[model samples]
Target: MTALPGPVSPPPRLLMGPGPISAYPSVLRAMSSELVGQYDPFMTATMTETQELYRQVWGTANEATLLVDGTSRAGIEAALISLIRPGDRVLVPVFGRFGHLLAEIAERALGEVHTIEVPWGQVFPVSAIEEAVVRVKPHLLALVQGDTSTTMLQPLEDIGALCARHGVLFYSDATASLGGNPFEADAWGLDAATAGLQKCLSGPSGSAPVTLSERAVEVIGGRRRIEAGIREEGDEDAPDFIRSNYFDLGMILDYWGPRRLNHHTEATSMLYGARECARLMLIEGRDAVMARHRLHGEAMLAGVQGLGLVVFGDVAHKMTNVVAVEIPEGVDGDAARSAMLADFGIEIGTSFGPLHGRVWRIGTMGYNARKDAVLTTLACLEAVLRRHGASVPSGGGVDAALDVYAGAGA
Candidate 1:
């Protein structure tokens, strides 16, 4: 066997890809701070502080707000498995791949899932969803707010109110949109919402912060914790049964509640990162952060178009942070992406479903949502495309991006 290297350093890549966006320097510093016992005074205080920080990020007053010690998918799983019963019907609007993941998780938790779908790269109309809710009369309705797979952002304003009128418990996964797009969990009538720190949150991808409404809490309360060793002695107040232990939201709530029961060991470093992510957003103010994302994202979009690549999607309904560009004929999209990463140390993404080879997804999110980052990405991308024999309009992409940046400042 060949001898392996002891350690390695990673190449610096500008992550203009789908997620795990460039991490904040301050967030990394917070993660590197000295560790303490999970329940230590300082640790607990920080944990409580993290919760408060997320409350502002989520714009909700729900008492069940807390972090799942895993990725954004963990938060989605917790919400789905907890709310879904053995035979309950769940309505999921399948607009993109992530929406299908929600239905899959709910089905795994024994939910009878019904789906209403549109073509990929498109969102379902509110009337379509309302029709499904009226037909299925589901116990819960799940949607993905911004799907990176298709670079489509669903309009939630009217859909949330429609769900309320239908008496359906509404939930959304805002992983791709939170912080970079407009989201008001409480005001939006969201029953439960979950998001990861990977996207516009500008943190590492371990912790998933979530919030749930009072009605969501009540729906979850019907099921409580089921202890392993104490199976013989069932509680008189307990429901018939509970689902998987690791994904149990009831036990998680209690642990995060006043009782503070022990669940999984809290990921200390990740908690620090999550807290800093929200703290920075709050310090900058949400509107200002959103504006920054908007400006940078638009610059990147303009730069890509200036490079002669056609933009994808209904431009009017596109999200602020990520843009999809159509792959030019005779150019291998994967080759361009590989050269960008291997040669230039810049990463972009490809689309999903019907758009697998048709478009590339580029993002300007979080720490990378800036003038320099946008210019750098465009410059590097232009070089990569030129190397593949594509005629790059000289100085076009970078010039357009710079113009957008300067105009925004002016």
Candidate 2:
């Protein structure tokens, strides 16, 4: 007889990895809210509210702030495809995997992509990026603000000014850093920026929150096209319309803007979750949330170093949400990771490309960036290390973390 599977259930896990960390409890509840018809007045109101909330989150006055109904990468694709016409020159500075991803996406958009690279564990200096910008004379500068692969946060403060000076449009993928780290889209002079809710926003990865400045809007507006079935009497489609229908930001903006033109039926549940994520961020106050992440992040750093683990990357420029620790000699990295899941129910992460199997990435972000979470992970990690025959100091991790909290009067 064929047996049917039961209701799905996942094991309890402390997600202390680079992303997709444990979501905030309220966000989970928000997703389960009952749905409404896509064009229902209530649904539209919620959509408008979500847009306004994300404006505060992105620190932008741009009217194009809204959600892209997919993961973080969807936002990146939408921005790139909409902004880059075929044969447009695009410059990307590669410091990690995601920078390479930006370049690849640009290539697919029929762009003439040029990339300047630094080593895996480092970030490019603003001068080097400017030098590339001067040479390439690109139409757009695409960059990744916080790349988890190398645990590096590229400094964007000056890069935007460099782009402005060069008359190049600036875009950044802030998926891994947005909520937990400090990001000011308007203040930083970013023409466009995108992020997902999964990382520091404490929500599942489905909806992507995006914002665009007036300059970006003007560029995308030139490529607007209404589909055949949706064409109205006065509608005029551009000759060089955006290539991908799903990723056309112009059409998306019309749908999300005052026109409220229907593009596709919105993802209702994901919208609810995304709204709650931004609501929580605003209610807690941005400065307070940033400080919380910083506090917990420092504690985790102190804890890991106290265990005598050598951290990878330039610590000074590391993102406040995640850190990369070198795998001790004689330790089977994959085996230890498996044991952490099997024995302790904690999930850290493995590196990619050059750092694969060489370092473990530990994250202190979102809901899991609490004092208890940090201490528990450090204690369990110390136990796991001892069981794997690695010499570890007794109570070293926890004590060090506690000292950090105590000194901060937390």
Maximum-TM-score candidate: 2
Task: Write down the TM-score of every candidate.
Answer: 0.94, 0.96
Candidate 1, 1-410: lDDT as tens digits: 99998787877889998887889999999999999987788988888888888888988888778999899999999999888767778999998899989989989988889998888778878888888999999989999999998888999988779888888899999999999999998888899999999999999999999899999887677555333323234354333445678878888887777778988778899999999999999999999999999999889888998999898877877889999998888789999999999987889998777889999999999999988888888988888888887887987999988888789883
lDDT score, candidate 2, position 303: 95
Q: Which 10-residue span in candidate 1 carries the lowest summed lDDT? A: 225-234
Candidate 2, overall lDDT? 0.92
**lDDT for residue 172 in candidate 1, whole number 0-100:** 94
Q: List all candidate RMSDs to the true structure.
A: 2.9, 3.0
Model 1 alpha-carbon drift over 4 Å, by segment: 1-4, 225-241
Per-residue alpha-carbon lDDT of candidate 2 for residues 1-410, written as tens digits (9 for 90 to 100)? 89999999989999999988999999999999999999899999999999999999999898899999999999999999999977889999999999999999999988999999999889989889989999999999999999999999999998888899989999999999998888999999999999999899989999999999999998777545332334445544323547898999988998998888989889999999999999999999998898999999999999999999999999989999999999988888999999999998999999999999999999999888899999999999999898888898899989999999999999
lDDT of 2 at 316: 88
